[model samples]
Target: MATSLPSHPIGVFDSGVGGLTVVRALMDRLPFENIVYFGDTARVPYGVKSTSTIEHFTLQIVDFLQRQNVKMLIIACNTMAAVAAEKVREISPLPVLDVIESGALCAVAESKTGGIGVIGTPTTINSNAYARAIHQMDPDCRVYSQACPLFVPLVEEGWLDHPVTRLTAQEYLKPVFVEQIDTLVLGCTHYPLLKPMLSTMTGNLKLVDSAIAIADQTAELLQQQGLANTQRGMPDYRYFVTDVPLNFRNVGERFLGRNLGAIEQVSLDRL
Candidate 1:
């Protein structure tokens, strides 16, 4: 795979629309690198699934992405990262990056008080991936985690700052506040969409946008691997989904902060 040219597209996948947050970050950070994104909408919300099931789904998606000849793989989904990241790394020939690793580094760097909170899907929080990652770099840092299952559905619904969203944020964050955490990790890509509401409610806790960390780290890795794209001008982007919901285009556009090109639907059966 190292023999592959830098011009090859980077492959990124998520359970559904939330992973677009990472896609948006990658576009902003590496404008010259083409991207191929896959969303497993048919199996959306890997949060509630067993670890084995999530790993199986992740392997399937990674296999499909590999068929596209992507130069790199970014496991942009938090739940998948929590459960299947190691298996992906062990099996894939491409360099693999995941949100938890970058997010942990950021949390450690941003936490002045040594008290950090992480919020994501129930599966992610239960897996303790973020906590383990943070502890690896800063053993003394206190880690607290919560699962904000409602946030994904709310973001998908485009009710970013709706009264209900705000109310839910308050409930989800109350325990973290009691811990007096000075830093917070938006464990799920979807949670970043609620930054305004999260910020207004969380007081001064520094929020670590894992998307930014992952983007920066990806750029660094690409440069180190000699895989950074040298192409000038615009880079092409292609999107795929396992199942296309009725409002997929609009929701995706909102998450991506731009117009979406052709979005094709795909299924695991083809693999």
Candidate 2:
């Protein structure tokens, strides 16, 4: 059996800084737990990649995190979660938590009319993971999915409320609203960065941010597994990246909602 401990840092990875939203939520939800975050900055924008390529990249990150001795794993990237979560679980001895599953659960519980909408990258939407997950939970729930292909780039550019971003959001969400959904799942991790604007644009639609949902689910899972960190002082937080592109710290801190502190760059060859 794996010798997982409550004090072992939880491993979180994303194609890029998007997953930091989940890390931010986890910080707020579980203030005492240690965290180790990895961002594949060099090979980001995995949305355009093929299934086999995405899966290959995801497993490499999982293996690296496993070597870090994480007590648990959180697949914070929607694309990775949709494509490789099952594969990761098969090889990982540690408990795995994914944002897609958490978001689906939250959507089902929040939707009163059983009308749910999901917005994500082309890959996630194409995978039909959110709709399938939602339907599995509640067969009666109607799922409306949209591929907001530009949101990630807009978010990465730090145009959270730019006029162009707002216009794009309006154009992308129009069809979803036509379905009369009461709940909208921000299926992509990066989508949470645009929450304030999304909330304003999507009036009265309950927004299920996967970051927050996953954090809540993580807390519950830790409690159930008796792995909730007991020590309360400042916990360790480490960040690893394949490369530090221009404005990496700035964009990352924006996603994290705080200073990124010191970041260590690791080569992909190391994985």
Candidate 3:
């Protein structure tokens, strides 16, 4: 039998621009695949919402991506990944990948002392998703979780290295530091942008970003399924947001570490 070619773009969605981190990793790891990214900026900060609301929003985004004929879907937000991943998998026709479990697995694999610290949005920490996943992998592993609610806004405001970010990181990570964890997972995609401040505060703890792990897993899954895009030409990437900000292009360029072309705005209600 002749093999079929994979042509549909991979779809990635997040509550805001944070998921661009995952996109950047995907570009480096799977350069031949086209990408379609969606940001729920109009409903930004899914962290503060209830689980049902997050699930509803996630379903909507997944449906929109399905309409776009994406080959796979990536839930790039930790909170959504924690609360709605299975729900999405149940409903989505394409393979669905999430950030939390991938990060938890990486932290568990890297931890020598079985002490892992996770810092994420309020919803993600409160959900105990990382702790549950890590503990399930290794019952003896100790998981410490903290809610750094301000980190998302700080990252959105482009205050990555600001003194305020340092102070905030110190305050948020105090409990985790006291736990003496050997591995720290950046549970929120936005948290990676604040890595310098987090590292300075955590002091010697190994930091793990889910983006790389998710990218690696995505690559493996594609290969196994025989859905890997083998094109040698330059891949195309499209970005769409519920609400386009004035600095969307500039901020996105910094986050993705590359120039983003046109960004289209879409109405969530219509979708």
Candidate 4:
């Protein structure tokens, strides 16, 4: 998002706390940039919701973030990226980025055998968004997909390495493993939190986390736009949510790898 407005905070949002992983990556990659994050905690799990509803909620958050005067927007929820990115781009004033397309591009580059595995929420997997994006980029890539609906809640609940989580991964990944894919795309933002367990399960397989791709692109865009923040001190990190600010405060730190200080509970209707 190259822009004349270099000081505007970068806006990032998801259906819930999972998007914090993207925020965390941005923090690591662009420590001096300001950030404003909104988690739709009142209505979590956008993966199960209908496309129209996802678009509605997404636009509401985008409107709210636009009011904050952000220079860029990142759709960290894979499901929303799959179903709602076009609408988001249509309405957003700033540059918009999504997780699915980035991961697909990365998978195509990282895969050695042209065999790639994708795992995401049922809505995301059922949509076949990753496979399509991969094939569009490289017609020879073989795509294997699985929908792990339980992974979101499991990560939110902080069951990162629990046996139940491992067992669940084992069961869900059985088919993908059979495809002999060399690269696995963690299609959902929430799946990154389960990295340790997933690493053990998909041994010797390269894991493609969309956060890296998104962060790299964000930095590249910032440079291209001459909007890179040049300040050196700690930058502002403010957070807002639709509901349960405290709950997000509790679970969000794990996703963010730091305390989410002074979260504001907002009513989108009021905004």
Pick by lDDT: which candidate is best? Answer: 2
Off by over 4 Å in 4: 1-4
Question: By descending TM-score, how would the candidates be arranged?
Answer: 2, 1, 4, 3
Give the TM-score comparing model 1 with the true structure, all chains together: 0.97
Candidate 2: the clashing residue pairs are none
lDDT (tens digit, per residue) of candidate 4 on 1-271: 2343788899999988989999999999998999999899999978999888888888888888888889888988898899888898998668888898889988998999999999999999988889999999999999999999999889877899999999999999999998878999999998888888889888899999999889988999899888788877789998999896888988899889988888988986765
Candidate 2 wrongly placed segments (more than 4 Å): none
What's each prediction's clash count?
Answer: 0, 0, 0, 1
Give the number of colliding residue pairs in candidate 3. 0
Between candidates 1 and 2, the one scoring higher on TM-score is 2
lDDT for model 1: 0.91
lDDT of 3 by residue, 1-271 (tens): 1223477789999988889999999999999999999988889879999999999999998888887778888999998999999999888667888998789888988999998988888899899999999999999999988898898889988899999988888888777888868999999998788887777776788999999999999999899988898787888899988986656677778789888888989887767
Candidate 1 residue pairs that clash: none
lDDT of 2 by residue, 159-208 (tens): 98999999999999989989978999999988988989999988899999
Tell me the lDDT of model 4 at 202. Answer: 85
Which tens-of-lDDT digit does each residue in 43-107 have in candidate 1? 88798999889999999999999989899999999999999999999999899999999999989
Q: Give the distance in Å from residue 270's predicted Cα in candidate 2 to where it truly belongs.
A: 1.0
- Model 1 misplacement above 4 A: none
Choose the strongest candidate by TM-score: 2
Q: Is candidate 2 or candidate 3 better by lDDT?
A: 2
TM-score on alpha carbons, each prediction: 0.97, 0.98, 0.95, 0.96
Comparison by TM-score, 2 against 3, better one: 2
State the displacement of the C-alpha of residue 16, model 4, in Å, after optimal TM-score superposition.
0.6
